[model samples]
Target: MSDWTPAEMPRLDDATVVVTGANSGLGYEGTREFARRGATVVMACRSVERAETAAAELRESTSATLELDVRECDLASLDSVETFADGLAADYDGVDVLCNNAGVMAIPRGETEDGFETQFGVNHLGHFALTGRLFPLLVAADGIDGDARVVTQSSGAHETGEMDFSDLNWERSYGKWKAYGRSKLANLLFAYELQRRLDAADDDLGVRSVACHPGYADTNLQLRTAAESGNPLLKLGMRAANAVLGQDAATGAEPMLYAATADVDGGAYVEPGGLMNMRGHPTVGRSNDASYDRDDARRLWEYSTEATSVEFPL
Candidate 1:
């Protein structure tokens, strides 16, 4: 449906949903709706204090009986991801949805705790390791209700992304935006490849891997990037552009909600359906040609497993 909204989101009662970056932006918006709809939302965030504040607000605003689990999960650190997964596994037998929604945008060139490019590490490899570590819980959820979903949040910037396997860390040279794009591209590759692996496996696990992007959403990411760049003019220009062209974070979260809950097939790419797929209701869409490259996906998967020291159960 072209005009889908969160109000129409199906009841997620009796589900356990994990959302990374749940402290703010699109993750916060999605968490609100999920909690309102009775799903136990795990707020996996970088800051426990901020997440606790967000959980309090979400509880007060949504339902008195809303269930929220705030956990510390810093995507920049592999050990943190593992710890988060271990905690989830210890408490929950299965998880119905895992939203790989945490990411860093066009920030200055930096390295994650694992010594990888910040964007590539946080945006792609972090999620890769998290997904693999949580694979058992997802598989155990196979017959709990219906297909469990892994909703990965990418970006339109992925269209311009190019994978340079030779130097994914950007050691020789660094372009912040380029690295961001490449990381987003890797998100799509991982989403599609996960679906393919699931389908080809001996057992039908009923875990759908769908990717979606929030087009031009007015979130703090742009502001933070501009502020971190130490460019006043860029900050002013970005503020103006966001005010003019960006949609609110809640509106931008529709595609992710749709991909996570709608009757979409595995590997579907959900995005906004307005002018140039920028801002509107959620709709199934297509990504770029390069994103569908199987060779690159395979290479990325291999390198990611080696880098993160995590393996998919496929």
Candidate 2:
């Protein structure tokens, strides 16, 4: 990790940062830190009530010198994703940073509202569609101190995943962790591809896509998954890991915070700088070798466009 801490983060007095899943965990931590640095924050979440409560708590704890708006957005629903995009476009000409941080972890097999496998749909397609819908505004926005960024949250699990397009929805078989890995891998591929397209676009657009991972954070994400998975052994194992190996959510949020706010190139992957990357400070990182496959990324992009029906204006 770099020597950069939240205290050294750049001020964003005129910036707007949109964070999905802002109701809890790293999303909430990122929102709080961004707001603390004077950025107008849009807390996009699945539940409005939870979002409102989180916003209130954020306000109470942090001395924000800017604004915060909590908007409802269910990533599993295409309608909700479009609605959230429409609302943001109507309210703001553009936003400085878009943090695609909302996602599902290892959980029981399920389907999204649009019938996509739960993990692939919410973790990959949801953000893909959201970014496509919001691209115009992203291209229009002036990055607070550098270039506008679409910071997608990826994970270490991606190292073990591959783009099984034939089984993209995991219809024939399923493993929660494998599904989770596939989604994270897709996240990296999408970020890299988006950055490639932006790099080829008009320089005036001043937009780029980057990615990061939170490392092993003891957030409700895992606990929730285990509880809902109906597997006592899985639940117990996860609980044990949380108690012994997990870092606090705030520490885990550092890499993402750095990736979103620091002056960095598109396609860069930020991760925790410590032993096995489980806990440490923010640092410039790299994804697995598979994540760098241009052909895979392009194919995934095309398929995602077809899947989500939201095309980028590149």
Candidate 3:
């Protein structure tokens, strides 16, 4: 799959893809490709109005028959996650793909509606609950010519992440980057554990849980972090770095698209195949050793299930 691009993706005429944070960045780029290739893409965003606006833009530019379903899903709130899943269940019989793409980068410490740290809550816990709630639908979609896939978007930062179960919420203190890394590490932990569980169940459920990362994409994620940090020098530095080293959203989204549609293995981590894993086409990249620790993943899973109350049917 060297130099693989969106042009290489297969047509998804009957697929249903739910992409969180679909209004911007890599999510938007992935949604555009899915819809253009004939999938019914659900734009799951925190703001319905903004999602509608992005949908409108996609419709005007994409295929006339593009089925872009706009839905509101605030990942910072557990109730919102349940509501979104409930609504989708009522309308769609199955989901071919679930793209856990919505996330927050390095930002000021805060709390979600559920009392968890903002980054961990939205980036890991929210997606954890959403995937658990949607497990039935994912199982139902299995064996329909192919398997249903869950693409959890992780990052290169996971290498530096250390799970602090004692202070999961950063109640004592918080380092923005550290918290972000932990959450991203949790993403991989959850993704791999889900696949392991599915295999152990052996119930013939063909739902593949994979992970991916966009290598230094020049998206609003960095800009928003810069603006939110409110440091002139930091903002200037981010802008200069983005201008010099970042790739476009389209290029950054290739790994996600590949993981979602290509013949990838379960628990595989897709990433850019360039030097330092920063800028290139989609490839099956590897995560740090900590990400593959079953003990940590199980502990995180138990804690998340207790916190979110969304149990997996596996």
Candidate 4:
């Protein structure tokens, strides 16, 4: 656990990693780095065609030693998540890293395939269920500095989140931006709570659940959200903002990459080491006060278990 940055990240010669939304944006950037460092990356994406195209593009630019495999796993569908987890467990020896990087932003209010709110369902519960389903593998992964890592990518937007347990599905009212905030906050809560459980578990398995946020870097997330939001102004504004103020997507992936490979402890929050956490190299940072509320985390965990029907290995 020495002081290290993304440039000092250790290579993963024989590690196997699973990254959702690996077809583009932060997920792809992280996957590219992992693959470049000689890890076998399983690209979990919703569309096989897009995943293949992205993988091929990476292969073209990446070192020939890199290995990338694409698999279909749509977070909006619990059934699909279950199938993906089952397939991963059967095919891989153990997962060294599980990057819950796939998520939607402030898109239009909608429901997932399972009738849950789109943001909460895909961004939080989907990853929640996926992580729970893969808990055994994470526990069994071969340890380098410690055990396997469950790196959940959260966001600064969490500062604005207030988890509304009563109307999680947004049956009463739906606010796209607020829902996005809630999802990011849930990512932090789940990561911290999972770490607590891991620390308390009696088993020798020493898995770590860590959280990280790429401070605002330019990614297609904003554009996608705006496009789907059906707000012409939002779409124009985001595109303009990204063009003018955003950093590169690869740079945006630095914090997450550091979190995945650094000598960090469970519950650590990695943020860009720069002014206002907007952009810079990956380094440790602070989360908002609401993120540390244990009572709320517990309640959220319970509700997540009931909602997803996938309980953690507590």
Give the per-residue lDDT of model 1 (tens digit) for 1-314.
48899888888788999999999999999999888888899999999999999888887875458889999999999999999999999999898999999899899999999899899999999999999999999988842248999999999999879999889999999999998999999999999999999999998887989999999999888998999899999999999999999999999988999998888999999999998999999999999988899999999999999999999989
Q: Positional deviation of 252 in candidate 4, in angstroms?
A: 0.6
Report the lDDT of model 3 for residue 66. Answer: 80
Model 4: lDDT equals 0.89
Report the poorest 10 consecutive residues by lDDT, candidate 1.
139-148
TM-scores vs. true structure, each candidate? 0.98, 0.97, 0.98, 0.97
lDDT of 2 by residue, 127-151 (tens): 9999998888887899856578899
lDDT of each: 0.92, 0.90, 0.92, 0.89
Record all residue pairs in model 1 with backbone atoms less than 3 Å apart, i.e. clashing: none
RMSD of every prediction = 1.2, 1.3, 1.2, 1.8
Q: List the residue pairs that clash in candidate 2.
A: 1-273
Q: Which parts of model 1 have CA positions greater than 4 angstroms off?
A: 142-145
RMSD of 2: 1.3
